[model samples]
Target chain A: MSDQTYVTSDPRGSITQLATPSRLEYFFTAGTSLSKNLRGYQRGQFIGQRCPVCSKVYVPSRGSCPVDGVALTEEVELKNTGTVTTFCVVNVPFAGQSIKIPYIAGQILLDGANLSFMGLIQECELEEVRMGMRVEAVWVDKEDLVPSLASVKYFRPTGEPDAAYETYQEYL
Target chain B: MSESPEIFTSPHVLEFPYSRSTGPVIGSFLTALRDGVLIGIKGTGGKVIFPPTEYDPDTAEETSGIVNVGPGAVVTSWGWVNQPLKQHPLQHPFAWALIQPDGADTAMLHVVDAGSESAMATGMRVTAIFRPADERIGAMADLIAFVPEEAK
Candidate 1:
């Protein structure tokens, strides 16, 4: 876009400001643990890794457990189902926001994964979103799957009974 | 896990995507660049800073005013990029240099298209080459690159 320039009048003096259009392009490599998780996504699976020390699984692991500081050695295939442990409704509009306003940006604790990851929660009324709400991954068409988390378009309410608060309270 | 996952690599762009107020000193400097001219602000001890900041780097004193500096410059220091990256200004190899333009006391960062690594050297005279007038905008990229000043 053409840069927009403006003259601002203030009590002190008028200042000239320009809207500087900028872009930074670079390559991003999904290293080890994330690579595994994304590879699973391409095959219609949710893969997590288990921390040997704490036995806790990390989805989209950072190649190691954050708390235990040890390599996550065991590979665990998790269900697409998950729980909305926490969320906030984005009602305010700002620059560079891709999703529409009033949508839920939730922390989803995938089944069998000890930790949660942020994902867009959709396909339900905004007021219906809540902690302990059961949700499921809504993936793109099977053939459209790729080695990226974007393969799953968003998470949606699963119509199952809400996971008990105690079941995911530790995650919050 | 028995089998290691294949490493996945993809291009990612982290962007600020917002307009920032350049204020007085920087605003004038960028405006000069868009006009195909170079300017510097007078600092403490009468030193001129190209790509001027609101405050003098050395004394932290407010700069006085803008002065026309250079279409000519000197390479104070430089490093060669043997293989240029995609984001680099020049698609091919070039020397990233700290160049002090003529009439400016402080050095500004820019690239020198000296054609080959052997041709680049500290204290080498160079000249700023601005992009076509129509392509000019109030940004650093307005000056496409510096080239070796023709031997006098």
Candidate 2:
């Protein structure tokens, strides 16, 4: 494809610049741990793996613990409910972004999982998204389920009292 | 608990998702390629550098002056692809070569359509074959591939 070029006047000579566009596509395998996690999502379950050395459970584990550098061999079933450990309001937009502008992207610490994962927080005003806010996964219809994170729509406030900071401080 | 299933595989697009600015020096070189001309920049030690850069690779001094170079080049080394990937420039078997244009001190990487691996060799001369004028868009893809000079 052709690049977009711009010529601007300058003291010495006209300056020339171009925006080069490129793309690539390939197959990505969701190895052992993640394959189980995604398949669990299809069944409306949240499956995580526990590292034997550290005992930290990771949702969508990439087969091993990042800190311990050992295989995560134990599978733990976790609840969709979690606490918003930290979050940011996304006001800027970019290409291929699916959520509307001004949405909340949050780090969620799921119940029974030792680590947190990012998820979209919705069904509340931007100012209402807090570090300890309780949230839960809102899944798509069962018939529409897929073996991917997309099976869960956005997470929303569970209306429960905010989780105490002491409960999720380690995640932050 | 049931045994874990086989690992899942899905199509993925590893995209750069961004465009980069080709500054003045590279902009000029690509612009010329779009115009059906191959060019080089004068570098340190009186060497011509193809696919010109802003600075000489050896001395790091800013490059100066432009000169028309090959349509003609010589293959310095090459690797043969028995089966091409989806992203490969050519669909059939081809050789990825380190080619030095007639007067260039540095070699540029490009593909050679030598028809068969048997036809490829070190020191073989090749010439650039450009895409049609209208199809060019100020990029390296403007030069489609090189072919053996004897067959040109």
Q: Write the per-residue lDDT of candidate 1 for residues A1-172, one digit (tens) a residue.
A: 2112222232323335667667877777778788888889889888999999999998988788888788877899999999999999999998878887878999999988899999999999999999999999999999998877788899999899999999999999
Best by DockQ: 2
TM-score of chain B of each: 0.88, 0.90
Model 1 TM-score relative to the real fold = 0.74
For all predicted structures, in order, the TM-scores are 0.74, 0.79
Model 2 docking tier (incorrect/acceptable/medium/high): acceptable
lDDT of 2 at A18: 55
Query: In angstroms, how far off is B109's CA in candidate 1?
Result: 4.1
Candidate maximizing TM-score: 2
DockQ score, prediction 1: 0.34
The list of candidate 2 runs beyond 4 A from truth reads A1-28, A49-76, B1-6, B44-46, B58-61, B76-79, B102-106, B121-123
Q: Residue B56's C-alpha lDDT in candidate 2?
A: 86
